[model samples]
Target: MNYEIIINSIASIGVILSVIFLAYQIKKNTQASRANYYDSLNKTNMEFLRQLVENRELGELLEKATSNWDNLNEDDKRTSNYLFIQLFRHWENMFYQHKLSVLDKQLWTNHLNTMIGYFHHDGTQEWWLKRKMAFAKDFRDFLEKTEKPKQIYPTIKDLTIKNK
Candidate 1:
């Protein structure tokens, strides 16, 4: 009977240790998933930026769309509008994921704030005005409720000067 008791106690300890190790593993997996989510988001955003840098025509269309929509020719307008829709679709996915708590709050908010900053432009604002209703209602509601930036994000030079 004593031997049985000792055996049971050892088994109990083992079970407890297993539970603790599983808990640690669960936590680690959760963290890794979060890291991966943010990494994917970064990659998507970087690709968009890279496209703007590498394609001169795309870069010019984006500039014209943001600064003066009227300056665009018919082809430019079609291209600009297409690009804006694609960009917004990406952001809408981010918004939906963030709403579902799939995204880390701080990371999502950082990206959201930068996107909202871009929406401050007249051309983007006009596009949103025309097409806001076409998006998912929940995503549209979130965008409508969030505060947009009053001014465009500053250039790197501006940031450098301000930090000095």
Candidate 2:
């Protein structure tokens, strides 16, 4: 009977240890998956920035539209609107992901601050104010609540001026 009791105790201990080990492994795997998700988002963001950097025409359109929308002709306005739609669509995805808790809080907040800076730029506010209906309602509400920061990012013109 004593031997049986010892055997049972050992088996119970073994089972408990196995459970703990599995839990630890699961935790590590979850962390790794989250890291991978963040990396993927970073890559997508970098690709968009790369397109802005490498393609001067796109940069010029964005620059002209954002800073001087009042001066663009009808064709330029349409083109600029198209360009901004492409840019902001990706941003919309990021915003939703953050809202769903897929993105880390601090990372999303930093991105949000950057967006506030963009909103404060010359013509961006006007553009968004008119085009706000195209985005998700919650996102539109978020933008409404966000106070535009005093400082804006350097315009695309500034970055591309060296190339010219």
Candidate 3:
């Protein structure tokens, strides 16, 4: 009878130990998952900030190029056109990747139209300056109109905040 009682006690202790170990493993896995999720969210937010700065810089460069139309040498003009085209393509790539807002796409389209308008009037350098100013105004309007989402979703916020 004593032998049976010892065996039962040993079995009960073993079961209790196994349950404790399993619970600990589950807790560790949960923590690791939370860490990974937060890390990923941080990386994404960083990328978005970086991309926004880059896009804004590109927009400024295009605006500068448009302003220099009167003084630009033929080669400089060609280079400017090439750079603007490349910027447009990059903007399109970002849009397709879902990294840019829809309003951004419309803003870029307005710039493209303005560029087309410049070339469309090939004969007259006289109207170039006026046309450029008009385009700039259109671009400013676009900037004023496009609004960013104030706060990301709670899931995104939860992931962004560091685990305690």
- The most accurate candidate by TM-score is 1
**Tens digits of lDDT, candidate 1, 95-157:** 988877888788787888777876776677777787787789988787777676766765343
Q: TM-score for candidate 1, please give it.
A: 0.79
List where candidate 1 sits over 4 angstroms from the true fold.
68-71, 154-164
Model 2, span 1-164: residue lDDT tens = 99999999999999999999999999999788879988987897888778868987776777888886777888888988887787678678878888778789999888887777776676777788778799999877887787766566767566677678
Better of 2 and 3 by lDDT: 2
Which regions of candidate 3 are displaced past 4 Å? 57-164
Candidate 1, residue 46: Cα displacement in angstroms equals: 1.6
Q: lDDT for every model?
A: 0.80, 0.80, 0.48
- lDDT-based ranking, best first? 2, 1, 3
Report the error of model 2 at residue 70, Å: 4.3
Model 3, total clashes: 0
State residue 79's C-alpha deviation in candidate 2, in Å.
3.1
